[model samples]
Each structure stands twice: as C-alpha cells, then as structure tokens.
Target: MCNQTTTAEKSSPTHIYFDSPEKHCRGTDYLCCSISDIISEAKSLFNLAFPIALTGLILYSRSIVSMLFLGYLGDIELAAGSLAIAFANITGYSVLSGLALGMDPLCSQAFGAQRHKLLSLTLHRYVVFLLFTSIFISFLWINMFNIMVYLQQDHNITRIGQRYLLFSLLDLFTNSFVHPIRIYLRAQGITRPVALASFFGTFLHLPISFVLVSHFNFGVSGVAASASISNFFVLISLVAYIWVSGIHEPTWEKPSFECLTGWKSLLKLAVPSCVLVCLEWWWYEIMIVMCGLLVNPKALVASMGILIQTTSLLYVFPSSLGFAVSTRVGNELGANRPYKARLSVAVAMFISAIMGLSALTFATALRDKWALMFTSDTQILRLTSVALPILGLCELGNCPQTVGCGVLRGSARPSTAANVNLGAFYLVGMPVAVGSVFYIGIGFSGLWLGLLSAQVCCAGLMLYVVESTDWEQQAKRARMLTCIDIRQPDDFDCNKGEVEQPLTCSA
Candidate 1:
C-alpha cells in the first residue's frame, strides 16, 4: 500500500517548545513563551548567521580593496572603476547571484528531507543552468562599452570602465561555478568553510591589487584582474575542502543525465527569485546611474558610490539573517515540522529588528565620518553625510523585509515576494525618487528617502504575507517538492512515509 500521512498528523508535535500553546500561535507572544525556547532559537540563528555574515563581509571587502587601489591611481580611475563595478553588478553579478538562489529551496528542502541524491542532482542542474546563463551575461559585458557610450557617459570614464570590465569577465565563469558550490554547502548548514575560504581570498586580495596595479602598472584593469583572481582562489579552496573534508559525502552523487530533468521547476523558482533580488539590487544601481546624469555628475556619482558601499557593508547582518532563516524555515518545513518553521520566522524577525536598530544608530552617528574612508572632497563628503542618515533609516524597514522575503522563499513562495517588490519599488518608489531628484531638486537625499518609502511598503506587505501563511500547507508543499520524483508513485509514497519519523530539531 502507498504510504499515507495527512497534514493534520504532521502538525501534532511529539515535543513542544512552549507549554501553553499546543496549536501554533499567531501572536507576538509566541516567541516569548519560554526563555529556553528563545535561547535555543537565538543560538541556532547565531550559529548560522555569523559565518554567512563573515563570509559576506570578506567577499565584499574584495571590491573595497579594488576601489582603494584604483583611488591611488587617480580620482578619474576611482570614479570610472566604481561606475564599471556598479554596472557589472546590475547587468551581470546581481542577476547571476539571484538566479543561483533557485538552489536555496531545492537543496535546503532536499537536505532536510534526507533525500541526499536529490540534493546532488539539484546542485548539478544549477551548475549547468548558471554556466549557460553566464555566457549570455558575458555577451552583455563585451558590449558594455557601447552601451555606456549610447547612454552618453564621459568618454574617458567610459574607456576606463570598459577596460576594467574586460578583465573582470573571467569572474563570470568562476562565480558561475563557485556560487552554486557555496549555496550547496550552505543548504547543509556548512557555512564556515566558505567563510574561511573568503577570508583567505580577501586577505590575498589587498596585496594582489597592490602588486598588479602599483607594482606592474596595469592600471584599472589590474584592480579588476585582482578581484577576479581572488574569486578563483576562493573557488579552488572551497572545491578542495568539499572533497577532502568528506562532510558532504552522503549528498555527493556521480553526475548523471537525470540532472537535466528539472529545468521547468527550477526556472519556475529561479526566474521569480531573480526578479525578487534584481528588483531590490537594481534599484540602487539605477539610482547610481541616474546620478551620473545630474549636475556635478562626477562628485555626485562618487558620493553615491561611497553611500552604496557603506550601505552594502551594513547590509551583511540582515542579509545573513535572511539566508539563515530561509535555511531554518525550509529545513523544518521539509521535515514536516510546521510549528518549528513558524518559530524560526518569529525568532528571525526579532533578531533582524534588533540588528536594524543597531545599524540605524551606527549609520546616524557616523554619518559625518563614514565618507572620510572613501574620499576627502568636501562636496562628496557633504553629500554622503546627508544620505547616510536616510540610508540608516531605510535599514529599519529593509532589514526586516529582507528576512521576510527569505521566509517566503523557504515556503516556496518566491513569486509572492517578487510581486510585492515590483509594486513597492516600481509603482511607489521609482516615481517618488525621480521626482525628488529632478523635479523637487532635493538631490541624492531625496533619492534615498524614496528608497526608504519603498522599504516601508515592502516590509508591511511581507509581514502580512508571512503572518497569514498556512504553515501546515507550506510543510506539505515542501515535502512534495523535495521528493526525488514527485510524479512517481513509489517516490511520492516513500516521502509520505518518510515524514512519519519526526525530524529532530537542531541548531
């Protein structure tokens, strides 16, 4: 007989974290029910979040290192390199990273369900899909010079930007491979290896950029080349660790033709995931590009770059928590533990709120001083100070919204998050931003305020969606989706029976 277990059966937990509530609580007090429960959730979140945040910080420092090297070259080189990096992020890097996120739901759910072979196949498929996607993105980079020219950017800056992008093209292929490997490991809660690899890679980057640009006189191209080379180093190190460590041995399967079979489901999630990320990432890039068309374009563009970098630096905390919660929530749901999944979301939001407040205080307090790290120009510094407070305020909403989106992804609801982003950023934020910058004449400060508005809107929408979510249904969906072959009777039946052995909760 086919194995059968209903949602009602899975909803009843053998072990309860809270004393009073047998049923899942939608109230805020749910998280505060027991001190021990809160402590356990915090420990689990911190363990996962710390390494991811550190890895993000280490990786982000590579760009900062490159920018510092270029700054020594000249203001023009600094401005041009920044522009090229922003453009690359919008056109290439962000898209690739977002698309690769398709693996999050699949791999995390598969690992949670103990479907080891399914995890291996999904990883292989993403590798293949991302590599093909990189080729098209590479074509865009090759033609970026012309695209910049058509946009009527400065001739000298355009030339320098093109040179930087030419060398940076190598990262396209390297990252295509590296990102999936990183995500595959992350799905299994193995974040320290990637963090270690990023630390070593970034530690090498400073000297590499110094030698290539200053010692060899390769100019801006050297900065770009060093960044790409550092990524390759990280990739090599991660691959070596994965093989030698044997930690992921059970999930490692020989490459097979069956890996090609999941394009439809993967793309269904990937396209929306891409849209979800790109909508948010590309907004900042668009603001940077728009700044280039303003009066005092160079100074404004440079100031915007500093602001973007600073915000990105602070963003590591919330983004890390988002990734952590996604894994935690998805794992619980896959294991058919709806109560635990809801608890993870509550804990993640609480953590993000505290982090957001801390970020706001830091950004506001250092508004005057933060820009000094990047540039000394009085105008650029003044503009950045004006924007920093707004950027900090924006984080209050942005951080929680980020975690909220992660909850949606874990629940197999990327499309819902995508729709919220579309309406919030485009329908509401973009118009306000354009009017503020051009018609209202408030400049970069106005641009940030618009973003803050969008964040507020997104946060409200996501909170509602997550609050209203049917955890039992989400758990059912996760089980169905993670099955090796949901269409097959034996595999489908096997998955239903698999959930009978309740998943053990661990940090």
Candidate 2:
C-alpha cells in the first residue's frame, strides 16, 4: 500500500487517467531541463536497460548451455534434442506463453488506472488456471515424444531420446508457472525480483548439471534432472515472494467468475499470439528435420544446434523489449494517454532493430567458430558455415518482427500480428524457401531463403499496423471495456458508444 499511486483513488472507470507529465513537472518545471536533466534521463534509461538485459541473458542461459552440452552428446541425441526442443518450444510456448500474455495488458492497465485493488485475485486465479493448463500440455507433450520414437524406428538414439523427453516433461510443468509470475511482477513495475531469480536459477543450474552429467555420469537424464530441479526451485522462489513480500493482490469478489467471464477478451488476444509463435517454432523444427536429410546429418545437426543457441540467446533482448512495450504501452493507453503509448512503441522498436543488427553481425563473424565448438565433424561444419551468413542476415528482420508482434500485443491487436505471420511465413515465406531446396537445388540454403522472406515481410506489416493505429482510438476502447467515463474528443470514437471492442467475442 505504501507504494500505491495517487491515481488509484479516482472513481470514474471510463475516465481513468494517466499521470499528466505537465503536473509531474510542476516541481522540476520540465518545460526545460538543464544539462543535469539530460544526464538524469540517460541514467534512468540505463537503470532500466541493465536489469532487462541481464534478465534476458539469465533466462536464456540454459538454452545456450544446453546446446553446448547436448551437442556433444552424439549426432543422434543432438539431432533428436534439437528437433524435440523446437517442437516443444513451438507448441508449448504458443499455448502456455500466449495464456500468460493476458496478464500484461490487463495488469498494466490496472496499475496505470490505479486499480491496485483488482490485482491480487486476478493474479491468484490466473496462476491456478495456468498451472492446470500447463500440466495438461506437459502430459500431452510426453505422449507425443513416446509416439515419435515408437512410430519412427527403434535405435539407440530413440531410446536415449525417450530419457531426455521424460526429463523435459518434468521440467516443463515446473517452469510453466515462471512466465505468469514474471509477468505479474513486470506489470507492477517490479521486475528486479524475476531478473534476480533468473540469474540465481541459471547460476545454480550449471554446476548441478555438470556434476550430475559428469561426476555422477547421469548423462542425458542427468542433464534433464538438473533442469527440472532448477525450475522447481525457481517456482518455489516465486511463490515465496508472492506470499512473503505482500505483493499487490487483485480481489475475487464472491468468486463471481470475473476471470472466466472476461476471458473472451483474453482469448481474442491469446489465439493470434499463439499462431504467431507456432508458425516460427514449427518452421525451426522443420529446419532440424531438413538437416537429417542432408549428407552428414551429425555435423548438420550440431551446427544448427549452435546456430539455434545463438539465435535463441540474442532473441532474449527483443523479447524483453517486447515485454516492455506491452507493459508500457498498455498502461499508458489504459490510462488514456495515447501519446505516451505511441512513444513507448517507438522506443521499443528502435531498440529492437538496433539489437537485431548487432546480433546479425556477431552471428556472421562467429558462424564457423560456433560449429567447431560442438564437434569436429568437418561436413557438418562446412554446411553450417554456408548457412550462417544467411541466418545472420535474417536477424535484422526477425528481431523487428518479434518486437512488432509485441507492439501489436500491447495494442491488444494480436489477431493482426497472427494474420501477418501466417501470410508472410506460411503462405509466402516457407513454401518458396523450403521448396527452393528441392525445386531449385539450393539445398538447406534455399530453405533459409523462404524463412528470411517471411520474417521480413511480417516485420514490415507489423510496423505498418503500429503506424496505422490511432492511440486516441485505443483509449476509447479501453474505456468501454472497463466501463469508465473518460473524455471523448469526437464523442464518435471507433467504439462509437459501443460497450466493447467489435472483435471481442467468445474464445
């Protein structure tokens, strides 16, 4: 309660307002700032950037290390692991990750509107729902893992893969709770906890993994158990924080089913977000499958293992930026400050683009060295060397597209993001790129051609959508849903006196 903002007291739901910068500057007279002000602004930005960047690295550290550790586990295991992770990441991330997204816009808007009283119950109930759904999905994934092995062909690799799958299944259930907890903290502008927790998890994970896999000779299962152990610890940490730290709690009035009743709105956003995630994830899985068909599958798989690790690690930056965009933009918009929302979008996109290009440069330079880090397979290394340049180039588009979708999520326009990805990646990008391998005899390089085309086009379309959005119009939509009376410039806003967004429907 001590951290509560003054805006929480306002009674008008439709008229909830963001803190006016004009009023905020009264003491400092922000109309103009001295050189010290510029320094202060930079410092503030740095404060924000460091934690988010560090958080990104910590969160992704596991995947990066896994690629290194597992790549040496042999080609079959390596290939199997890459394909498995891709499949799980795509299907699991889409379903589970998309569900967690409901909190960003909802919770940020609540905080910005000074509706702190609404948070506790929402957070609690949402967690329960997420945990249940994630468990179901985990079981499903485990089954699919078994099916993939039994149906394909019996080999030493498949047997070992089953062990990996079993371990991965356990880890998934534990980590599923992580996203919601992290999102809840970010929504309340309390990010340091999650970041710190991630750092601890990653740090603790490495030693345990090394010990189990090497000292104890647990091998694949050992590595897998370590991951599960780390995730379980992190989940416990989050729960402890929520209970002991007296975090903001949304009310559940008489168990009125507000969350379920209101989930239609959430679903509108979740479905498209899921689609966007699935499209990319599935394609990467296809990439692994493609590697298997090549002359030296072992080298091909290991090189790609390195490549994916590189991309996944870099992806964390844009992901955090996207998270920032959704939180900042949704909060400002919900508080009826369209201008601030626009500014937030601009800030996120610019940073994302810069990070993307930077990642591409590193990927290009380190492509060869990366493959060698895994194994000395000359053939695989050569294939990876050939593919790295193109993959590196794709980052420019991939990063923006990632942030672009995040922007749309903030705008509560996930459907738009989903459509663009489907059209660009599936309809346009994948077919041409994948087909070129056989059709044009370009091999795996041709497959990448399809990928880059889709991602770039998707990114462009996302940017256009962001540009076309009128925040003023968004503010009106926010008001109608919350049932608050806010100022109306034209009194003929897009909602046009309607009670909800036109797209709002049962999921």
The C-alpha RMSD in Å for every predicted model, in order, reads 5.4, 7.1
Which of the numbered candidates is closest to the native, going by highest TM-score? Answer: 1
Model 2 ranges off by over 4 Å = 1-49, 145-156, 247-262, 486-507
TM-score list, all predictions = 0.91, 0.83
lDDT of 2 at 428: 86
Q: What is the C-alpha local distance difference test score of candidate 2?
A: 0.66
lDDT of 2 at 328: 72
lDDT of 1 by residue, 1-507 (tens): 111234323243322223354333433213223567767877888999999999999988887877677777877888888889888999888988999887788778878888787778877888899899989998888888799888877778878999999999989999899888888888899999999888888888988888898899999999999999999999888888878999778788888887677477678878999999999999998887888888877888888888889888988999999999999988887777776787788889888889889989999999999888777789988999888899999999989999998888877788899999999999999999999988999987889989999989988898888877777678777766764334446434542444442111111
Clashing pairs in 1: none
Per-residue CA lDDT of candidate 2, range 1-507, in tens? 001122333322221123353443343211223346435433433455467767878767776666666765667767666656655676565677777776666666666666554454456556666777777777757675565555443345456655776777766666567876677677666777777677777878888888888789887777677877877777777677666776544421333455454455556655676676777767776676676566655566556666777677777777767777777776776687765666566556667778888988988888778778766778778877888888878888888788777767766777777788888888988788767976788886787788888878888887777766766667666555444444645564533455565332111
Instruction: State the number of backbone clashes in model 2.
Output: 14
Q: Which ten residues in a row have the lowest lDDT in candidate 2?
A: 1-10
Q: Give the C-alpha miss distance for residue 5 in model 2, angstroms.
A: 25
TM-score of 1: 0.91
